[model samples]
Target: MGDEVKLFGMWASAFSRRVELALKLKGIQYEYIEEDLSNKSDLLLKNNPVHKKVPVLVHNGNSIAESLVILEYIDETWKVNPILPQDPYARAMARFWGRFIDEKVIGTLHRAIIFEGKEQEENIKEVHKELKLLENEVKGKDFFGGDTIGYVDIVAQVVAFWVELLQEIGGLELLTKDKFSFLYEWIGKLQNIEAVNECRPPREKHLEYIRALVENAKSGSK
Candidate 1:
């Protein structure tokens, strides 16, 4: 009858949440399939045989792996509420910041939380460096999109939401208001968006999961 849009995602994954936010913003009705990463499903395996990762989008039996690719596909395909900017240069800038967040910010912040001794300190410094770049980008803007949550903001859900929760459970500090004032406020703004807010995992349960991860990291380190 209509487009068969389906998303395979893990609840606590920020990457999966990005796809969900994009879909919601574009008013695209789709079925969301929750994935158990530990023991992935046959469909998920078949869809994303390469990486075997969650956040695989299946549109009319065609599967697309990777969250960034899925976001672009959704935006291009739907074209209702544009997740990315219209201008050529603006869209490029959005993609740039999104890539920067994925490559530099997310991994560094996670390592900063999970590592100990000299490694943790180094990762924390890297986190600050990476966030300062984002802080500069968000300067004089309400959101990364400069009025609403757009692609960069959606991609940075890890920085906005998960980092805060991880920081709380990990007993570490990276995204501080004093250091990155704009990003702190940006986090508040991003979380306030109805669509973005709706895609988040329950805070308590997520914290519990993060705590387990931290404990496991500690055990493995020893």
Candidate 2:
């Protein structure tokens, strides 16, 4: 394959990791450029001028920003190990859920993790409300993609891993096995995938980073 694939991303970002997982799942070889988000790179800024975020995928000199967009591009560009479903409606649902997770679930989950007392309680309630929808979605399936990991599963990396650690730091009980058993089981299945598992940030390093964030939030509140 003469195609050139490159990913600009931050190590700790779940958004960045999803792109990595897509590339890995598709068996695509590419260069990984680790970006320092504190000091934005000229290339990242140029490629993704609007968002100026990490996880800009450059293929053969064409840049694609946004994790969900990049995943679809990867799936379409490389025919191997299809990320989205073959059925058009299923694919649309995958995209829909992927967007819902990013727009609705993730931010609320983060708020649930950082805020304390009443705010945190309210955010936690909101998270449970959103996740119950997901829990119901995954009730009878091994994954959102049915048996195999697909677009929705890849997009849900945050739900599978980071939130658990965030809950630990915040002393929240958001995703307990009893409450979201199917979603909990789905998380396990995603974690067990070697391709996806390898793309995750190191557990200890990730925990340390999140702990520092919580500390910073606490200090800022004072």
Quick one: best TM-score, which candidate? 1
| lDDT (Cα atoms) of all candidates against the true structure | 0.89, 0.90
What is residue 94's positional error in candidate 1, in angstroms? Answer: 1.1
TM-score of every model? 0.96, 0.95
Number of backbone clashes in candidate 2: 0
Q: What is the lDDT of residue 43 in candidate 1?
A: 92
TM-score result, candidate 1: 0.96
lDDT of 1 by residue, 1-222 (tens): 999999999999889999999999988889999999999999999999999998999999999999988999998888888989999999999999999998888789878877889999999999989999999999999988878788998898888888888788877888888988898889888767899889999999999998898789878877
List the lowest-lDDT window of 10 residues for candidate 2: 108-117
158 in model 1: Cα distance from truth in Å? 0.5
Cα deviation at 143, candidate 2, in Å, is 1.1
Candidate 2 collision pairs = none
